[model samples]
Target: MAVIITNRSLADGIYMMEVAWEGVVSPGQFFMVRAWETDPLLSRPISVHDYQDGVVTFLYQVVGKGTAILSGMEPKNTIQLEGPYGNGFPAVDTPLVAVGGGIGIAPLYYACRKFKEDNPKKKLRVYLGFSNEAYRVEAFDAIADEVVVDVGGIIVGQVDVKRGETFITCGPRVMMDALCQVVPEKNPVYVSLEARMACGMGACLGCSIKTAEGNKKVCKDGPVFPREVLEG
Candidate 1:
């Protein structure tokens, strides 16, 4: 369902938090948002970074047309959102390691906030990697234990992957794959995928990901999924 909320900008192009919603919004759930009515495209899917009180927050880079519009809104301004969709990151009672890169950092932020609430006793570690220190998400510092950013901090190439017993992520395929390789096949590992999506639902059948269980939708079935499921 669509909920109207007042939005605020924390930074000119990076941070923005929203407050105003009537119901529960869980970790890893996304909001379908449309900031400009004149624009031809429909609402864009943005993952919830964290929500407290009646406020919901999102941290995104100005990477596209839709997000650029969203990044421009002022405080007390209202925006439309349809939301809290898709399966969330599975609850892990044990220690969890969250890894992220670039725009993919939002999902892990949501997870860390939830962990602090639900599993206060468990050790929750968070790691973030960006192309360089400049592009890194500093917001992760509050949520993560040991944050890393460097060309060679965790894994290399176009991906940011790290494996600890209990781990989850949202980033490029190459980064997720590197983390998957280190985490034992038997151990539980969750990865939030960023696959191309024409429609953020299963109807388009556009975000199918090759899996052991067969192709899966990155939007409907995921955006969050088990790492083992991706291993061939």
Candidate 2:
């Protein structure tokens, strides 16, 4: 169990919650979070927005009953956090480009920060898309060589896919598909997918997805996957 350090609003229906966590969390991993013990039967999988010191942050939108409950909770409330699960974005030595849309931007912040820390000399660019209001777009300025924001339009068009550049993206399926269509098959493109999960663990087989390699569970095998695997 983790204690909520802060629960505040970022924009309408969007929230940033900080929890006291001492465990190691990778940039693209997530936690199955639940604030109530009994009311909601399942925990919501929330991507790690950022982690610093002893706090793990979650940037989420109140999209359903579970998230609505989470948004209503106050500081000091105890919540269950089941993991730092699944494969995270791999460390890359090449110039990196990260693209996110709406709430999918949650995981890219930490991923970009870590990449910059490890590869200070390499170029890092970020593009964020929002249907309406934009938040935290300025935060990328510190870590990215370039940052671009698009409101109410496709953000992927701004990306200049260069050879030898590694691209990682999480967004609406349509946006990701469009990006993939433009990227050469030889370039490495990683995608983070979203699905409803009954159990964060693989035992339940609740979040299985069809891939090139038969079937894989999102909670166990990935929430992040190579673009090629998805294509096949």
Q: Pick the candidate with the highest TM-score.
A: 2
Error of 1 at 151 (Å): 6.0
Off by over 4 Å in 1: 1-13, 134-139, 143-145, 151-164, 196-199
Question: Model-by-model lDDT, in order?
Answer: 0.70, 0.91
- Clashing residue pairs for model 2: none
Report how far off residue 195 is in candidate 1 (Å).
3.3
Candidates' TM-scores? 0.83, 0.97
Off by over 4 Å in 2: none
Give candidate 2's total backbone clashes. 0
